[model samples]
Target: MNNTTHLPVNPYLPAPLALPLSLVPGKTYSQVMARLLNKLFGPELADGELDFLEGKIMRVDVVDAKLHFSITLSQGVLAAADTKCPHDLSIEGSIYDFLLLATRREDADTLFFNRRLRLGGDTELGLYVKNFLDALELDDRIGPFLQMMNGATTLIGRIPRLAIPKLPFPKLGRRS
Candidate 1:
């Protein structure tokens, strides 16, 4: 008997791209995320604005994409955690929701309130991270690329979310 299942169509990665994406090494995920995050939050790192993350593990779970990335801050530098170790905090959500949050299309509070994003682990750490995300500002110095990406994300959000069959999505290893 066929065991294929269906899930909402993803406007972000699509079924084809999702497969290969999942095969990427965990180290690569860490490297890419660390580089991008460091670039985006360099000032905060230098100014010690993110010192609270020192020796802390923050895991981001992109459910639809079947990807998990763990990051840590040490000596004011952001790097990827090299193992499948436990996390001090975890932020789980779909790619679309993450895009919305990052693009300022939706605030972190609203997403958590609406249950689109789930926050787990140390409450104190979670609250601090949540506040940080909510307070993120897209200034001109950060440039207009995010604005353009936001437009694209908004358009992608409009795509019908009806279930797509035979998507080959892996079983979600939800945390208890």
Candidate 2:
């Protein structure tokens, strides 16, 4: 559990998008996730072990002109990984819907039972990751990463808050 107070400039990749200054938001899964885990848990990985896993886990296979992600989780660490990429969970729905579901962990199992999360591959892996991810509170870890991806500020200056738009609520006004 090594924590990094400052984000080092890793020359191997472009610095992730900054935060707090007004920037567009969209990121490839790998770029956003890699920088995130590096900053939050850089101490957790001493070498390229995580990166190797990154290539191993965060991958999409293409066959017959179709593409799908083949994710593998190493049990227990799933929670930590999810905290870093809450938006990228492989739930059964549009990416936006999945992100919305991710922000609402209390309803995750409900969604899963409702057939809203189309899971594939190892069930045990899914359960392990889901439980671990379910238990985590990752606002602190995710905030900087989101900010960095949004391109406003960086690890420097004040850490920006993770600003996910509030989900729209059902209309309850009296029927006309």
Kindly report which residue pairs in candidate 2 clash with one another.
17-148, 18-151, 18-152, 18-153, 19-152, 19-153, 21-152, 79-132, 92-117, 92-118
Model 2: per-residue Cα lDDT at residue 61: 20
Candidate 2 local lDDT, 40-154, one digit each (tens): 6444445333332432243322121122333333431322232233333343343322443445522567656655456654465456556745755666767765544434222
Best of the candidates, TM-score: 1
Clashes of each: 0, 10
lDDT of 1: 0.81
Q: How much lDDT does each candidate structure score? A: 0.81, 0.40
Q: For each candidate, C-alpha RMSD in Å?
A: 10.0, 16.2
What's the lDDT for candidate 2?
0.40
